[model samples]
Target: MGPDIRTQSLTKPVTVAEYLFTRIHQLGIRSIHGLPGDFNLIALDYIPKTGLKWVGSVNELNAAYAADGYARCLGIGALITTFGVGELSALNGVAGAYSEHVPVIHIVGCPSTVSQRNGMLLHHTLGNGDFNVFSKMSSEVAVDVARLNKPSEIADQIDHALHECWVRSRPVYIMLPTDMVTKKVEGARLADLIDLNEAPNDPEREDYVVDVVLKYLHAAKSPVILVDACAIRHRVVEEVRALVAKTKIPAFVTPMGKGAVDETSPEYGGVYAGSGSQDAVRERVESADLVLSVGALKSDFNTAGFSYHTSQLNSIDFHSTHCTVRYSEYPGVTMRGVLRKVAERVDLKKLTRVESPAVKNEVKKNYEDSKTITQAWFWPRVGEYLQEGDIVVTETGTSNFGIWETRFPSGVTGVTQVFWGSIGWSVGATQGAALAAKDLGTTKRTVLFVGDGSFQLSCQEVSTMIKHGLDVTIFLIYNEGFTIERWIHGMEAEYNDIAKWKYTEVPEVFGPSPKQVKKFIIKTKEELEKLLKDKQFNAAKGLQFVELWMEKEDAPRALKLTAEMSAKHNVRLED
Candidate 1:
């Protein structure tokens, strides 16, 4: 007879690395993004064994950026890096995820437990012998931090961190020491699936809040629904959309909430960014007697430097974990659940339908098909070219502002780092988004709009994109420098200038063959128009890169106004 079955079942053992990666795999993480470091080498070895693909990134920062992108597309993402140096390098990217509410598990490999107890100075350390410094720093950005020193607590710690990540939709940190990578742990815990479902809310509190919200809705003569970025981050886009659809109310998206709802909807109004908003949007939103703002983040950029005229007395705000109607606030009343309740309880017949401005008003400015490209000519045309199911990523400068003028089709996804305002984030983010889209078997193309200055910050990730055979289309805005910065503070300063590279030749230099990639340099309206209509280009096969040249001083109207506001705030007032 073989070995006794009962004995094997009682004490089956597996490495800690196996346990962690297996747990991550169960959470639907098909690929891990990071760079190789000395401390993480052993842990990296267990990646393939656990049925996960290691996406070797160009750098730790890019790895984090890619992980954020992947998380937005795949629900949750994971990244691995070594201690101090590696973790610090990726902090900004992780911070961006934290700010925007993306769920990413940041696993950092540290020195062995023995070294930590003995206080040995390691290479990645600050020579202070204390390894808790980085964890403390990470605590500020991550929702939870888990330091796995004992093998017995590893499973519980991992499960807890992951649970927080999913429930909160925020990043979490896990420090796994080198010695603990191979430690034997009970294998039976793997049999239990991690619980990611949101906990039950108090029924009495939820019902009370819903009743108050309906009272306001019933009293208002003119009301509107405003969708923002948090709706997408909190996984409540469908709820917000349902609320708008059932009520047939005029809905407008904030700058950060661009693609959260279908722009093609009949009830959709344009973007609302305070003074920078479209004439109709500004008039309608500010004039409304009541406003239902869902998952709204009133950051400087999103609100056009706090220029909104809406009064708090008439506003009802819905957040991830709470709801506030005018001055009264209700904690633990989740936006997702509240939206569902509102949708179910709302009386459509009692609600008034207001007429919004005609969509044709957006096309009032006519282009003469000029040879030289202008911001006025570029944005509207690009808007016309956007297709359904395209994932659009914009950098922090001109791209972000100009994209606001473009309307996305149904099923399109928009990705930007507005609140964090990190430059050069779109390059790495596009790579991860493309990979995620591919993994989901979606034919959607990854389209990125980045300024030349921002592209230079994280351009090396293009190599990773080519290596994975991802279908991505890059529209590199070549204006010779940081156009947005110039508009903000320094119009002619040398600090805003950047080296101009042969942007069209980047794909060829980055290791993709001519046949594998398509390149274009567009300087005129005719050229852009021709390229947009090309069947092969629209197909977005392999890697497609277009270098779009424009005047250095040209910028979107919204960006110019917002930059002026920012410049005013930056100045010191001598009272």
Candidate 2:
């Protein structure tokens, strides 16, 4: 009957949502983290049908965070939200992902074609149009923009945005018009696109920079390696470790660059973040005959805004975009090629450090004595929980603080948004990381220790965790406010305090079941231990919440030191 009555379909027609989902699938993104808004309804309709999960987020910012987190763990994050307000809330997460060099795909729904023509005040319109905010954010973070102007551009744009994010390791925005989502498109397959161009890595400039760096390394009696965040993101940990071992030079990591070289290595001089920085490290850096800074940004925060009060002199900066042989002179080269060349020509055998037992003891003493504050208080225990293959994705406030106090756990990975300092990043990142862990067949648990304020931003993504049956546990430190901002600005309580929630109830509120997904709220150390011992609570649940009811004054010592550093440097804190 069907053969006689109906002709064979000439071609497969696809909706904009189907095209987008297919492209996202090709990008290897299996889930979409977002809250369905009025404008984004069509994309939501296609989620379940297209085999991609529509993971719910309580807030747009958190959805972005979750997407970012997922991207960090899973290779790329995809977020869907309405225009204007939704995108605005998610910007913090996208910005964080951008700074941290995580590739996140933001699929924001714009007003329909009719609304665009009218130019009237519309829902989710921020005066200058919905595109203005996202475009500005993308530009600021070195992100690529792919607008789906015509319905046909959906697949091509999504594919392009995803590819760009992988190439640059930054977030990219793909704006979807509401009208376009339900419209039909022809031959919209992202997998069919070809990337014909090669990324530029200037060889001549790299050689010149490498040659200059080798000259100093060959001549210097004491050569120190200063590592930063870029080195970590570049997956140069093995190279850094090899260099540290070959040189036998004391390696010092910038605050953002902690874990580049293992902390247990004989060469590690501890992290260089002003107050927490070892005096021995400060002195060694000051006295070094040659200083090789790899992937260092040398911003005010790392240098205490060039305060150099603790240490000074003899630094040759080798960074991502540029280099410096002298304090004032600029040299040309890309960081990776230059470092790769350094790994090739340096006197790998002769570099050795004079044993300094006293200095080592002093560094250990400093680490032990750091626990007088709330942040440091948790590190030693948290350090114990960390294992090989574990990945730590931290929120803005705690990211730096954790790095400052905690030495990189051997074999554990750390992810953060130190460059952008975006808040509400931790929880979002947790979901993505969990997905990554599962996909990679790693036994290591994905732990997210976000500040209470940050957790509230994307805490709703717990449902995604539940849906996937991921082994993700969140340690929500309920300090009840924006602790970082408070410390940085010394703001009044009104500016800092966040809304109170039954913190442990997050998993229950978002998860599939209250019994399967356990939530524990604690104020004291004893309660934490009791929950820690409860196997049923932590095991095999879709999600689990361990909330630590902390005091507003209980900021990490390193965070406090950051505030102190900000004040000393006279850097204006944003309200």
Candidate 3:
């Protein structure tokens, strides 16, 4: 073996593009999504040959969203696209993913160094000789923004991007110039890594706060845990569940954290801040003696605009930035470690008498009742229509309402871009999710409930669907505008309204193989029923698009309640 070393000598050194591709592989990226362009030719050439799957999208925006959905299921998401136009189009999705704490690696290809120096207007540019659009948006959305100015910066920038993802729990951006792709430089480490470092709390404050929290929990006759999206984003679900179990507290989760604890838990009361919530659940939360808000954001929608109708008697607020006790002059240490320590001291026998079989029954009853509302009614019906194994991706609008109302059967899964609440995300994300489901060998169907406005923004993904021959169901809620915005801000008759589509004609417009693509126009509830009952609709092989015409004036449960509550307080709303 030693004698054969010289005979089996290695070939010539690889280019920077080869090295970068190798690094991306080491980062555990299953696929790279985006459209190819002149500027990014080098990375594009290296991508497929290096063994990374290329999930090419029809456009940059859809590519970015697909990457986001992929990242949501699989830890890290990545997208590769050309300079200015491509990167700019993708910025919104990246920003949304960042806000929601989705880890995404953005590989943008820019013009060659010589062209940039000459100040030439590149393709996808706004007549300006710069490809800095993402840089501008990242000023607001990204946790960290680093430009790979030199070839030497690539390894470090990638490392920094991953670090930002772990520490800040958000998206990070890395810009790669076309000129730098094959440039020679010293490469650092070839992969990303994250290690947890336990930092000590301020001893004086930690002790005081721990004592107060313990006394409050021990003395309280009724204590409950309130979990939110923050808990999920922080990866603290186990920690929070441990705390709840130790304290023997009944747990009520925010709408976003619906699945944090099993819906079947004996101590679980259904979610408290969404369409499914009942007046009784509201009353229960408002009356509890000790409310441990573990990683709660208290968003306007979640808190009913912070009305404080909930029991303010002994509120323990735990947020990433601050921690405070009710009516306390001095604040306590952050919930970061205090929660774990608190969980360690709990008495599990402190179970409350409130845990009744009735609560569990009510969860089922509430789901049925919620289906009457405009937002939720669709999903319940859609659920009946769904096959045994299906993946439903919901957009940010009436589509989300439908998913919220629809219960997932044991083998089905649901996804939403809930963290950022960005409109037009579902259509693009659905393509990505479906692609993922296909790769996993799950014979489940992939379905999307997207809004008219959202579809208009990212509809180009239809081409990708056609190209891949993916069997996906796309339901476009044709409300003609940003339905959720209209409900929230009452910007009725504004530009938020969308132009209608001959929805059932989409596949025809895109050129269809009827086996792989079909479209439906459903106007009334009865029409929807007929569509759902039609076995052919579910069994059709290509891309099936269902255009459901929703009432433009339909109001969601939360919106209707908020309006009523506001009127009761005489809060003025602009017409």
On TM-score, the leading prediction is 1
Residue-level lDDT of model 1, residues 160-204, one tens digit each, is: 999999999999999999999988777788999898888756888
Cα RMSD (Å) between model 3 and the true structure?
A: 5.9
Question: What's the TM-score of every candidate structure?
Answer: 0.97, 0.80, 0.79
TM-score of decoy 1: 0.97
Error of 3 at 480 (Å): 5.1
| Local error of candidate 3 at residue 225 (angstroms) | 2.3
Task: Give the per-residue lDDT digits (tens) of candidate 2, residues 127-236.
Answer: 75444555566567647787676754555666677777776667888878788887776542443753623254578766776777777677777777888877765545
Q: Write one digit per residue (lDDT tens) for candidate 3, span 388-488.
A: 55776877756654443444443455567654677778877877777776666556688888878888877877877777777788887777788766655
Q: Work out how many backbone clashes candidate 3 has.
A: 4
Query: Is candidate 2 or 3 superior in TM-score?
Result: 2
Off by over 4 Å in 1: 1-11, 360-369, 572-575
Global Cα RMSD, each model: 2.6, 5.5, 5.9
The numbered model that scores best in lDDT is 1
Full ranking by TM-score: 1, 2, 3
lDDT of 1 at 523: 86
Scanning candidate 2 in windows of ten residues, the lowest lDDT window is: 355-364
